[model samples]
Target: MTTPLGGAPLTSLEQDPAMAGGDADSGDAGDLGPQPVVNRTIGRRHGHHGRNWMGHGRRAKSNPELRGGFDGLNFHDQRYANGGNQFSVEPPDQGLCVGNGFVMESVNDVLAVYDKSGNELVGPVDLNTFYGYPAAINRSTGAYGPSITDPSCYYDSDTRRWFQVVLTLDRVGTTSSLAGTNHLDIAVSQTANPTGAWNIYHLPVQNNGTQGTPDHGCDGGFCLGDYPHIGADNNAIFLTTNEFALFGSGFYGAQIYAISKKALVHGAASPNVVLFNGGDPNIPAPAFTVWPATSPDGQFAGARGGTEYLLSSDAVFYDSGTSNTLWLWSVSNTRAIDKAPTALNLDVSPLTVQDYAVPTSLVQQKPGDTPLRDCFALTGCAPTYLGYPNIVYPTPRPMAVNDSRMQQVTYANGKLWGTLDTDVLLADGTHGSGINYFVINPHSGGLFANGTLALPDANLTYGAAAVTRSGRGVIAFTVVGPDNYPSAGYASFDAKIGAGDVHIAAAGAGPWDGFTGIPYLAGNRPRWGDYGAAATDGDRIWTASEYIAQTCTLTDYLTAPMFQCGGTRGALGNWATRISKFEL
Candidate 1:
């Protein structure tokens, strides 16, 4: 998959084409271009007292609005990958001290980084690097404006390291997937300082063409996609990808791949892609399951490992007939993905099969198909309700049979947080708007629908909910639109705790004080488009999006109170400009 360069690559951005206007070496953002200004006003009153996007649902909110800035944090954007396009930051500790953590991102190439701050006196730093094959581009549109997808980040305090995972999409023309051209790339790096020398490692995948096929059919929807995840457990890292193809261009089928973290992080330079048989760690026979020709969409979360469990979200699919009903298979194992002895030993099974209004599926699908089983779906109009847009994390519980959206379950602040995109049909009898959230009591099953926080605003809605391991609060990013055209605009928002309100080991810790700072927005696009996806490491938030020329580029970045969350009034920067540090 490696594309050979014609000559020694241009040593710096100064010499690369498509590199201009902004200074490549200096982090100084240039003059604001011709862009419109939209006034944004955030206040405590706007917060509905922890209520979710919908007033009464599953997830619960303590304090909706948080504070303005965190002290001592830095944001960095790495330029080594596709046009220095990805961004990450090393977050500060609880008391404004530089933290020993780092995160990195990229397109098509695996983006990973490592930093040490609190554990050792090493300088708090941010580092990022990429190792993967480049995309084959169109002579006209230029890789068809290929952008990064499903980007994720992580921190390992024990190893004093940070890791990033991203899917580099490849396309031959303006629309659709490119066969065999798209593959996974993993890059690992070590950070000793915020800016200095670093080591790099690259791993390319070797596929058997059996377990992972870009093509499959579910509910008439053909095998359509892949979202891969990397997790740490038992002192080792694991990698895996979800297999789902669109049947009839609508529904999805399910399948999964679990790679050994030991092989990726500690094994030989070349590692082969491995499949999960079930839950057994002793059997070596390869018998991973493929989506039966009838499942809907297949989705997978990053791998998670611990002394007790190996967890992942296997596939999130909708039944073909109606949009109201949806299903999720939360795959779990007692042993880590790398240690699973046999395919059958892996314990791959669905614990819960949830049901929601058909319209609710519209949240993730946005302006696409509205099936009958969908909870948000109404008779003759658009379906409402939306759920998590990024990736989902798994916990010790096996709720696949009772859960339809695995991305809703997350580990943060040392506790478990769940979000549900509740579909509520208005009394008027027309299918429309609804609620989405984090901080729900999943133990009550989907019946206890409550979110930790809620959006009272009439225009904006929430979905993808992420929480840091601490669980004090979870970060919820917004996806703004159903208007369809990119001209209407879409923005991302974040809410964190206020310094005056934070009280550890006390009840006040969970209440939403309403973010003190102005809500952050992904800069508006000159053309119509949407935010890519979001990820986090407790203290800071990150997201990605694809660009089309003067329109946009799929880019990711870190947003914390300390970083001040750019894209506010007087801020005319692209997502790439707000970065304070660079990893790779």
Candidate 2:
């Protein structure tokens, strides 16, 4: 069974291509002529609170229309391998930060706090509770959350604070059904210690002219701020997101918010925020996810009255046709947010570089589907795992390598660096998935250096990079193909020398056996992690990526462990995450 790219599961309300700006291939924002949007909003301080502990999210079944996969298996996730009630969600998007002795990481909805020595300080807390919201799976009362996805956190040494952001959809009361309204919940730690009290601010992006959000015209309905990211300078904190219709149609450009970092650090009531709308998702050359660059040293470029740089890709799928154009965007006069009259400006210009196209879905090699002859002979899966009714062979699914969008961007060594998933020519001259790592001088808007790292047989996808003050860094991504399972990998880079050879940080134990890609009827595409993360400490860089940690035979999966597959993975999926730090 082969699942088309768009065949991945979607919610019943806004699943139509016509309604959600089509799939990765269809939303070609044709020629968005360089018109920078300028807008402003005065966001009120929602409140500040603390909930250091997080209980497990309930696995109760909700609206099947909101989730997808093999539900008959009673897996929390069905189609797209998305978990409805349980915390066993798919595509462990890695969001991490390492600074001031604390290593903070958030995968999907679970947040884990670790010390610099790799000790788990705070283990597996749900984001709902972290944000002062009601727990999704309340152990005592058995209540749960609406829907929270795409989490990002930053440890700013400039202000000695920890910032965490996530995209949250409005829930209908305390139940599982969605309320069709959404906002960005930004939390700031009062002290350097992240487990302490946190101040929370709510920035609504529905833009239907409600909830203090300006009317940006979201297909005549509320908009969803999908994939919110974080970046900061000495003056402010930048949060960017891709706006999509919550209940209606069309995909808008990237929505950018510039918040006063000082105000948040000082615990001021009602910090100022300037909103930059992506402008008309249906118009020509619509912007996708424009990623903001995080600064590690707190040393920012002192040009154009303090600047916060960003990078974006118009490769094939995002531009409708093939494109080699990379857009360089910046927010000038960012310091003006503190004054009564703000002079913030959004500048978007294109820089030509290596041509890139939509990449192929990653393939994996695992011992899942054996010969039917062996099963009939009772020598293989006939006795335990598959012999049972409703149990079937768990064939490795094709990892969903979503559209070619910009990955993490960072500022270091007076240069802006970033990554993007794109088609590359391998040593064999065949097209394969790889990353285009790039560097820019933000001042002159120049493409200083770049390289496309690819393997002869293996495909590299979901690139994440972090650079120190001296241009020492690593580009982290996942390696998978006909010969390799899903594994965590990285490459070293220096300003003098480009990216080095690919090194396996942690080898995958098995192939991708998640529910999203199981071969049932028209087989589905297992979505790989949507994002990968890397952060800098002093001379070391830390990275977290999705990899298969263990594999079990059919017989061992169903019985003794009571369907947890030897407690190596979730009950339904075979995905795990690995974090590794390299001392340069």
Which candidate's TM-score is highest? 2
Compared with the true structure, what per-residue lDDT tens digits does model 2 show for residues 67-164? 11100011121112222333445666678888888888886666778777667787556677678776544434445565667889898988889999
TM-scores, each model vs. reference: 0.46, 0.80
Question: lDDT of candidate 2 vs native?
Answer: 0.65
- Compose the digit string of candidate 1's lDDT tens values, residues 346-415: 3332223232321222211113211111111233211111111221111110100011222323334222
Q: Candidate 1: RMSD over Cα atoms?
A: 16.6
RMSD to the hidden true structure, all candidates: 16.6, 12.4
Top lDDT prediction, candidate number:
2
**Number of clashes found in candidate 2:** 11
Which window of 10 residues has the lowest lDDT sum in candidate 1? 509-518
Q: What overall lDDT goes with each candidate model?
A: 0.26, 0.65
Against the correct fold, how does model 1 do in TM-score? 0.46
